[model samples]
Target chain A: MLELKNITKKYGNRTIINDLTANIKDNEIMCIVGPSGAGKTTLLRCISGLEKIDGGQFILDGKQFDPTTSENNVVGVVFQDFQLFPNLTVMQNITLAPELVLKQDKQTAQRKAQELINQLNLDGKESLYPYQLSGGQKQRVAIVRALAMNPKIICYDEPTSALDPNLRDEVARIIIDLKKTKVTQIVITHDMDFAKKVADNMLQVQPIK
Target chain B: MLNYIFEILPSLLSGVTTTLQIFFLTLIFSIPLGIIAGVGLISKFKPLKAVLEFYVWIMRGSPLLLQLIFVFYGLPMMPGIQIVFPRFDAALFAFILNYTAYFAEIFRGGLQSIPNGQYESARVLRLSYWQTFRKIIVPQVVKIVIPSIGNEVINLVKDSSLVYVIGIGDLLRAGNVASARDVTLLPLVLVAIIYLALTAILTFILRRVEKHFSYWK
Candidate 1:
């Protein structure tokens, strides 16, 4: 479970996310939907401890999560840009965190990465880079990368925004399939239909500006 | 030319050890110093940035010949600071300092090109700052900065000759010594040939490195 208490973020004189508070329950698929510049993405970033909240507190699984206090690595993220290691293969990208962070053996990390790749239907694409893949393939790889780490929660920031309609639907199905695993998921997206289909709880964010 | 090469091959070979020493030593020190200086440029602290900026600026702005002379010959002239560094040490020191500044800019540009999202994703994975930097930032920066670094290294091979200005007997100096005594330009031309060969070999190696990094793509 996660609790964001009075999270307010300001850029210069303008407020982006003001006095926003929300709670995310364990195993819940929560989608944050809002118009452009509605602080939805910013809110997701704060929860992931990527952005500093000007005046607020974030508690993850009952522990205070402060980026200032060295935010814990209890969460995983799949960026809209994918952020895949362009110089590395899909397998390398997926296996990197586990091998380096968890000190998992190379064989074990490879095994897990392979399993995730298969699960995501990326069996033959392990040797490919982000540039070589279609948008949907890249998103799938990003999701598997987070899944390989086995984090308690995963966050997506407009992951399907860059994909075509068909690919977006495919990505949405993958997100829905992830929900069956009961991991806490927060997807920030503009696709209301996708949110309705995959999310257990809908959190509509209104821009403070 | 073949006869000339055979004639002075022994002397050139004698200078090889010193050339390699300077080459590897400069690389060993300048590379890490360059990365640190690069990170310092992007530091949030203005003072840190300013100080590192000034360092890169001064080292880069001044001529390497001038810095070599200043470090080896000029600094010894000071009153109380009579011995900042030993005479032989100054050649290595000057070369390292000059190359570090150039390499720093290459590193900085590479680091800047990476999207901010990469760091954010690394944080979400619970990677510590140093961990993220080592695993994510450094590798990518190396890939990006390599071409520039390779070029600098090529220049460094020729720059090794600058040690002669401070009285170190590098290849160029060796050629000078040979030419002065023999009254022929062959040794100097041989020096040019030696430099060109070294540079060509270096270019080949760098191309391989670049290809290796690009392999996954």
Candidate 2:
């Protein structure tokens, strides 16, 4: 289980998330739903170690975990726009971090990438660049890239924002199927319909009044 | 006409050697320095960004000819910092500094053109800063700034003639000598052809480079 205790974030003098608290259980899909500017993305950035939370302590399974340390990638984030490296093919994008940061050999990394590609239904897309892929295909590649790190938690920032209704259903199905793989997920979305379709638990974030 | 061309050819060829030396050396040193400076301009350290911005402003605001004169002649006459550079060294020093500033500004814009998601993505993936820069950022920036850098490179080829002001026996200087001595415009015309030829060749290479980078995007 992951715990967020008194999590606070401020941009300049304005406080965005003030004294927030939440609990996310193992293998659970928790969707944080709110109107725009509710700081859902900011909270995700904090957990992903991209943002430094002003007054928050993360306790993961009874251990004081600091994502900022970057000693270990305990969390992975798939951005909304699917920012895959354009210069690299899909397979290279998926395996780059594993080889460079995790010290995995090229064959070991590519083997793992092939497995993720098959699991995510990204077959035969390995040689394609990000610009060459369709929106849905790019998102799947993004998810596979994140999964390659084998993080304990993976967060999605507005995963369905750019998708059509058909692809939205596909995203929902993918999120539900990922639960079977036993990775905890926190999805940030303003689309309540998507949250309801995929979430095992839901939390609402309100703008600071 | 043919005999006159041959007579000036050897002198002009030596000048071409000098021009090419400065052109090649300037690119070799300045491009790498410019990339670093470009990164520095946008760095989180406000002081560094401010300093580099001021530097680029000063470099761009002035003429390359004046800079060449200053480095070669004016510096040695300055009160305390009377460091004298040989004529060739002074021309090279000034040219490198001038081009480095231009390339830095181009790169700064190129770096800015990248999406915020790219940086965030690298961070979330736990990519080391150096790895992120070399593998992800540099490739995109290079692709984006190629056209702009190509313009500067072509400009550099012609601007190499400015070295003549500092008493460097560059292509322009050699042509001037033969023209005045023989009392004919033929050597000067030959000089113009060589300049055009050099730029044309560089333009062709730049187009090829742009094509090479196009493979991804």
Candidate 3:
């Protein structure tokens, strides 16, 4: 389980996320839903250590886990726009982190990446660049890229924002399928219907004025 | 006209050789230096950023001709510093410094166009800073700044003519010498044709490169 206790995040004088406490179970899909400016992305960033927690602690498996917003932090994030490196093909995007950070050999990384690509139905699409992919394909490739890092938890920021409105079913199916990987999934979305459809438990965020 | 062209072609070709040398050397050194300086301009370190910012301001605010004059003539005469650079070295130094600033500003603009999400995604993915820079950001920045940098490169070709001010015997200087001695504009016209040919070649190469990057956006 991941425990976030009294997590506070601020930007200069204003507080973005204030004394937030939450518990996320292992191997579950947790959805965060809120209106715009409600600090939903802020909370997701805090969990992923993309933003520093001004106050609070993350306790994992009864040990103090200090994850800073810096190198080799064991959390993954898929941004709203799917921010894949456009210069690189889908295979390069998915294989790069494992090869560079984890020191996996090229063959090992390629094999693993190929597995993820095949599993995600991104098999022949590996050679294609990010801009060449559809919104759904890009989102899947982003997921594969994150998974390549073997992160403890993967967070998605508005995963459906770039996708067609009809593709929420695919997004929901992806989330449910991810449960078998045993990696905790945290998704931030404003679409409550999608959230309700996919969430094992849901979080609503409010910004402090 | 053909006999006149043949009469001047050898000297003019030597000048073209010098022009190509200076162009390639300046281009090779300045671009890497510019990328370093451009990224340095936004660094969180106040003193380093301030110094870079100030240096860029000086380079951009002054005329490149004045900088050449200063490097060649003024620096050795200063009280505390009296080191004299050779004529070729001085001109090269001034050109490199001036162009580095221009290229750096272009790169800074490229860096700015990058969305914040790219950085955040890098951070969360556990890639180190240098890793993110090398594999992710620089490629994108290069794509953004290629056209701007191409403009600078073409400018540099024409601006290499300015070396004649310091008596470096580059293409234009050779043309001027021939024009005066022979009492004809023929050599100068030939020189202009040479420059135009060089620019046409570069424009073709740059267009092909732009087409290559068209796959991305």
Candidate 4:
């Protein structure tokens, strides 16, 4: 289980996420839904170790995890912009972290990346750069890149914001499908329908104002 | 006119060769040096950053001609500093220092233009600091700075003429010498043509490079 206790985040004088507490059971898909400026993204960033919580404790599997001191790969993030490295091909992007951080052998990393590419329906697009991929394809690649680290938990920040209205359903379907893999997922979105459709348990973040 | 041209051509050609030597050497040294300096400027180390900032300030705040004179003449005159560089070496050193500062500032702009999200993505991907810089940041920076760097390169072609102030006998100096000896303005006009030709070639090559990067556009 992943748990947050009284997590507080601030940017200068203004508080973004204020003493928010939440938890996700193993293999649960938890959706954080709120209106804009409700600190949903800030909460997600805090959970992913991308932003330090000014005051809080993150407990994972009954063990205290320090965001400032611990290795950050425990929680992976797929940013709103996708933030794909434009210079690397899809295959290289997925394989790089495994090869460099995990010290996986090149053959093993390549094989795993190839499998993810195929699974994500990005089979022929392995050699293509991020700029060459469509919005949907790019999102899938971003998910695959996150998954490559085999993180215990993955956070998605405004995943559907970049997609067309018609394409938003595809992302929901993808999130639902991810639950079968038994990895914990935290998704932050303002779209209430998406939160309801994919979340096993949903939390609404109130604006701190 | 042809006889007059033949008389000055050899000297001008030799001078052109010397100019090319300085230009290539400065580029070889300064580009990499500037990149390192730029990275250092942005680094988290306060002391290194401060030292580099001071170095850049001095280099950019003063004229290249004055720097050349200091390196070749002024330093030797200092009581404790007994170093005197040869005229060509002093000019080369000064040009490298001055251009490296400009190049470093250009690189800093290119590096900064990359959105913060790029670094964030790399971090969450579990890439080591070095891996992120090498694979993610550097390639994009190269693309962003190419046009700016190209402009500086063309400027360097013109700036090489400044070395003649220190009596290094670059192409402009050869032209001046020939014009004085022949008592005509033709040799000076020829030097202008040579500079135009050099800049034209650089512009053509830079255009091709820009087209190459258009793949991302």
Candidate 5:
């Protein structure tokens, strides 16, 4: 289970998230939805350990998300912008994190990523660079790249914002498919229809009064 | 002109070995150093960033010839501190330091040009800073910095000839020696051809590298 208790985050004078808390269970998809600057993205960052909480507790798998003490508290994140490595091919992108961070052998990582590429229907484009792919294709690649790590939880911030309406439906379908795999996921997005499509549970983030 | 080239070709070919060594060494050492210094310049730590900024400032502001002389002759004359090495060692140090600063700025600009989302995406994937830099940041930075780096590399090939001031007997100096003996100015023309060839070869290599990273294409 992943839990955020009494989490507070402030940029300066303005407080973004104040005493915010939530619980996400296994095999569940939790969607965080709100207006712009509602701290939805910030909350996701804190869960992923990408942003520091001003005060509070973030617990994942019984051990709190502490960069200082934890040995292996892995959280996979997919950014709204789709941070694809421009130099690497699509296959390399999916395999890189496992080879470098998880210490998996090259052949093993390649085989695993190949399975994901085929699963995602990205087989023919395996050797293409990120720049060569369309916006939706890159987003799918980003999703599988996160999946390749086999993390306990996957977090996404505006994953389909870059795609056209037609393409957004395709990505939304993929997110729904990911939910069946039994990994906890937190998605921060403005697309309410998207939230309705994939979310098993929803959390609303309100701007500070 | 054809006859002149045939007669001087042997000696010119021999000098090519030294020229190639200097070019490779400068590239091998300077590229990594440049990336480090570039990161330093952008670091959140104010004191270290200021020091790097000033170092780049000084190196960029001064003439390469003046810096070369200072490294070879001037610094050693100071009372307490001394750089103990051969004259060529001193020259090499100057060349490396000088090119390192210029290359660092090129790297800095390339890094800065990348969108912040790229880094955020890496973090979300649970990649440590070093891993993110090596796998994600460095490759993209290499693509962006190639044109600027290509220009610097071409300049460096010609600048390697500057070692003649410290008596290294590089391509230009060898040409000078031949010119004094033959009194034909043929070696002067030969030096130009050699420099051109070096730049052409460097340009070719960089293009191949650029193609490897052409993800968008």
Candidate 6:
């Protein structure tokens, strides 16, 4: 279980997330929905340890999680823009984190990446750069890249914003498919229908006035 | 005019060798140094960024001929510093330092052009700082800066003529000497042709490089 207790985040005098609290059970798909400027992205950044929480404690599996001392590889994020490294091929993108961060051997990492690529239906597109891929293909590549890290939690930030309605439904389907694998997912999005389709639990964030 | 060219050809050829030496050496040292300095300029450490900015300011603010003279003559005359070098070495040192400043600015612009999303993605991927720069950022920066760097390189070919002010017998100086000896402008015209040919070859190579990067485009 992942427990966030009294989380507070401030930017100078204004508070973005003030004493917000929530819990995510293992393998649960929790969706956080909010309007713009509600700090949903900031909250995701804090949970991923990209931003510092002014006041909070994270308890994971009955132990207090310390961001400073821990390696903090527990969460992986898929950025809203897909932010694929433009220079690397799809295969390179998927294999990099596994080889670099996990210290897996090249053959092993490549093999695992190939499996994920096949599973995500990205077959035969391994050598293409991010620019060459369509919106749906790039999104799948991004998901595969995140999955290759084998993090306990995968967070999607505005996953469908760049996609058309058809692609958005496709992404929702992909998320529902991933839910079967029993990895926890935290999705931050403005798409209400998408939230309804995939979320096992939902939390709404209100902007601080 | 043909006879005059034949007479001065050997002398000018030798000068071309010296000119080529200085050009290659300066490029070899300055390009890498500029990359390091450019990355340093954007580093979070305030002092390092400040020092690099100051160095760039000083180098860009002065003329290349003046810098060559200062490195060759001025520093040796200073009481405490007492830095001294031979004419060729001094000219080379100045050229490298001056071009590095220009290249650094070009590189810094290339680096800054990369969106913040790239870095944020790397961070969330658990890539170490060094890995992120080497694997993700550097390749992209290289592609973005190639055209700007190519322009600078062509300029360097012309700038190599500036070494003549420091008494280095580069191509232009050879032409000047021959012109004075024969009382004709043929050697000077020949020098211009040689420079044009060199830049043409450079342009061809850079075009090939740009084509190579078109895979991303």
DockQ of each: 0.58, 0.83, 0.72, 0.68, 0.50, 0.76
How much TM-score does chain B earn in each model? 0.93, 0.97, 0.97, 0.97, 0.90, 0.97
Estimate, for each residue in B84-183, the C-alpha lDDT of model 3 and write its tens digit: 9898899899999999999989998999898887877777777788999999998899899999999999999999989888889899988989999999
User: Which is the better candidate, 4 or 5, if ranked by TM-score?
Assistant: 4
Model 4 ranges off by over 4 Å: none
Error of 3 at A171 (Å): 0.6
Q: Tell me the docking grade of candidate 6.
A: medium
Question: Which of 3 and 4 is ahead in DockQ?
Answer: 3
Minimum summed lDDT over a 10-residue window in model 2 chain A is located at A65-74
Q: Which candidate, 3 or 5, has the higher TM-score?
A: 3
Candidate 1, residue A67: CA error in Å?
Answer: 7.5
Candidate 5 off by > 4 Å: A60-74, A106-111, B1-25, B73-87, B164-170, B173-185, B212-217
- Docking quality level of the chain pair in candidate 4: medium
Model 2, range B13-56, lDDT digits (tens) per residue? 99999999999999999999999999999999999999999999
> What digit string (tens of lDDT, one per residue) describes model 2 on residues A38-123?
99989998888888899979999999888888677789998999899999999999999999999999999999999999999999
Instruction: Report how far residue A34 has shifted in candidate 2, in Å.
Output: 1.7
Give per-residue lDDT, candidate 6, residue B198. Answer: 95
Q: How far is B95's C-alpha from truth in model 2 (Å)? A: 0.9
TM-scores of the candidates in the order shown? 0.88, 0.96, 0.94, 0.94, 0.85, 0.97
**Span of ten consecutive residues with least summed lDDT in model 1 chain A:** A66-75
The TM-score measured for candidate 4 stands at: 0.94
Instruction: Candidate 1: list runs displaced more than 4 Å.
Output: A1-5, A21-26, A55-74, A102-109, B1-9, B15-17, B84-87
- Root-mean-square deviation of every model: 2.9, 1.4, 1.9, 2.0, 3.4, 1.4
- State each model's CA lDDT, in order: 0.84, 0.93, 0.89, 0.88, 0.83, 0.91
Q: In what order do the candidates fall by TM-score, top score first?
A: 6, 2, 3, 4, 1, 5
lDDT of 5 by residue, B1-217 (tens): 7987787777777677777777788889988999899999889999999999999999999988888888888887867998665767777788888899999999999989888887877666667888988887887787789889989988989888887887776788778888998897889888888888878888999888778656453
Better of 2 and 5 by lDDT: 2
Looking at model 6 chain A, which ten-residue stretch has the lowest summed lDDT? A66-75
Interface RMSD of each: 2.2, 0.8, 1.7, 1.7, 2.2, 1.2
What is the C-alpha lDDT profile of model 5 across A1-209, one tens digit per residue?
Answer: 88889999999888999998889888788999999989998888777777778999978768767633344536778888777877788988888778877889999999998888888888898898888898888888988898998878888889778779888778778888877667788889988999998899999988999
